[model samples]
Target: MDYIQPFNRILLVGCNECVTVCSAGGRKEVGLLSSALQSAFLSAGKSIDIKEHTLERQCDPEYVEELVGMMDGVDAVVSMACGCGVQEVARRYKNKPVFPAVNTKFMGASERQGVWAERCQGCGNCLLGITGGICPIARCSKQLMNGPCGGSTNGKCEISKEVDCAWQLIWDRLKMLGQEERYLDIIPAKDWRTAGGGGPRKIVREDLAG
Candidate 1:
């Protein structure tokens, strides 16, 4: 509310992707936010116009271009999506201000009902094939690649008792698959080039973009 309080005419955009599945930034969420904003403004004795729209995907220019017509009618955009969607909206609307309603969280998987756990750092290179499908970078507190650190106790990470040791899971999985020898083989340090150490990443598919 504080970020967008200045804008009288707001464009509330929602994404129907990861955020929707997580129940943070979907059509229903958009509606809820819109209602909340309306109620707040009404209580303040001020009226605001908020137009709601949910795109199939917000990161792509094709989906974002749908707003080209609507942009002229709105004052600013409040994107209920990951940072990527907010950035894309900002990129498309250079004249209008774009605000993010959701804090961008790490790439993760749903642990259970309303629970999500970080699962990938997107290092550009995946090592899941050797680690028994478990990501050490995301699961390990220290991001140890070779094996479990000295603090691993009873298959629990040193960071917390509830968290399972990633390397311990890997070793157990390798043993189950009769590939215990793989754990003995040490993994080398990760090259940070693919992990966005150099700069921002881009993927252009000539087959589609062309």
Candidate 2:
């Protein structure tokens, strides 16, 4: 079956927690997107049966239990949660098809209200000492460990005026902190082996595993 089609009866599910905090997908977003999709289908003379619901968290098995009876009549589920939440829902309902409504961005701390910026790449190595604490891998366009490259001009990245060169920011911060000497230190090339085999990666905590 073409499960994600507008012609089929579908459930638009949203997470009330993580996605809400991230301002990506939430109860309000669920309603907005569902209405928009329905309106679009109606405008095109195509009928769609869509129902909306918001769970405390789609990634939890307890929360997903609520969907047991609900799935019987739906053709598909459009999850408005992070990638992990979507996978959790799919794992619980193996018979049903689950589709993601939003793209998963990154693992970073929220910088401000309605703003989440990348701060770490989980590189398994900390080199903030030599880089003045600013992460060139995450903030720089080139993800250069030893950077500012030859193209940086007036503290701005050569790629775009909107982006300040990460190395420039690092240098400025280090200067303010009276740690400019750290900027002169060389950072060796990153070890990609720790990042896994350039494919799917898995972490097994023996202590936590049964």
Candidate 3:
């Protein structure tokens, strides 16, 4: 990459968490990236020593500390995990330059064999109970909580025909559950302060601490 300037040796670290399940930065992906980097460096008339290792979960400090044994002669690190994994690695090893190889997409679920779709936005307030289990905040393009937007036509969103109208799904599910009356109730506006809008979020559980 343009960022890995003049690299003689680099460590390719992979995460076996969400990235592994998504087939982005698992063990197999780490090997493939290592080979690709080796080929690129060789083609440029400069051989590179690539050390590949896949951590169980790079987001955890216990797993990130495993990189201590692999740091020798490593000019830089190429993290094939999500943004969280990359940041953890950078935080643990502040002296080394960590570069990301994969773009962190979203907090999503696997739709099918190889497809993943966004499911939750981690909003502090959850209204799935009233919305009939569908998250309008994430599924709806407009994030409307009251009712279906004027752009909804034939159960599909105006943004795209392929995208379903979240409100319509909620309505249909509520009707099936014999709770359509709940749809008539007005939902309060969201207080984004509890969400990331306030700042970087952190949870401290005094009960769990020793």
Candidate 4:
């Protein structure tokens, strides 16, 4: 917070992608945060100017380029996007001081209105095909691949009765799909490299590369 005080003008940028869907770093969230910051500054007897903008996707350079014109009088940038978008912004504008306003949580899906649940880990090797579409890596307390641990009881996770055991869900789904036999198959130790165990990972499409 002290680092931001030096800047007289801050640009609050938002993403209209995942953050918008989850109601975290969307345009609405940008406005709320901007107002809150302004109030805090005014209360402290300091004046600060904040400009708000929402990009279709802050992670894409084409969308981030829109900020070029908006950056004219901005002293710093505060991104209301996930970590990826923040890094993209930083990469595009190395001269500007860029900061993330929201913490990036796990890759997840909206379970219901106002409820988002972790669904994927972006492990590179997707196991949903064999796990009956349930991802144990993200949902399971221990991220067990082969089956449920002893902590699972009555289809509920040991962490909480409210949390459904991912393995149980996988088994039930596999049973319904007539693929219960797949559960008996042993999943080998995962290759750690694809899951970012090796430095930063990337996908380069030769056809799309310039």
TM-score of model number 1: 0.95
Off by over 4 Å in 1: 206-209
lDDT, ranked from best to worst: 1, 4, 3, 2
Model 2 lDDT at residue 138: 76
Question: Each model's number of backbone clashes?
Answer: 0, 0, 0, 0
Per-residue lDDT tens digits for candidate 1, residues 1-210, read: 888888899999999999999999999999999999999999998899999999999999999999998999998999998999999999999999999999987999999999999999998789999999999988999999999889999999888999999999999999999999989888899998888997987779998885
Better lDDT candidate (2, 4) = 4
Instruction: Estimate the overall C-alpha local distance difference test score of candidate 4.
Output: 0.92
Better of 2 and 3 by TM-score: 3
lDDT per model vs. reference? 0.93, 0.84, 0.91, 0.92
Q: What is candidate 2's lDDT per residue for 22-138, written digit by digit as tens?
A: 877899999898999888777877888999999999888999889888999897899999998899999999988899997988877787787787877766677776777888877
Q: Which clashing pairs does model 2 show?
A: none
Stretches of model 3 off by over 4 angstroms after superposition: none
lDDT by residue (133-163, candidate 3, tens digit) is: 9999999999998998899999999999988
Better of 1 and 4 by TM-score: 4
Superposed on all Cα atoms, the candidates' RMSDs to the truth, in angstroms, are 1.3, 2.8, 1.2, 1.2
Candidate 2 segments exceeding 4 Å error: 1-3, 108-117, 196-198
Q: After superposition, how far is residue 167 of candidate 3 from its true place, in Å?
A: 0.7
Clashes of 2: 0
Q: Worst lDDT window (10 residues) for model 4?
A: 1-10
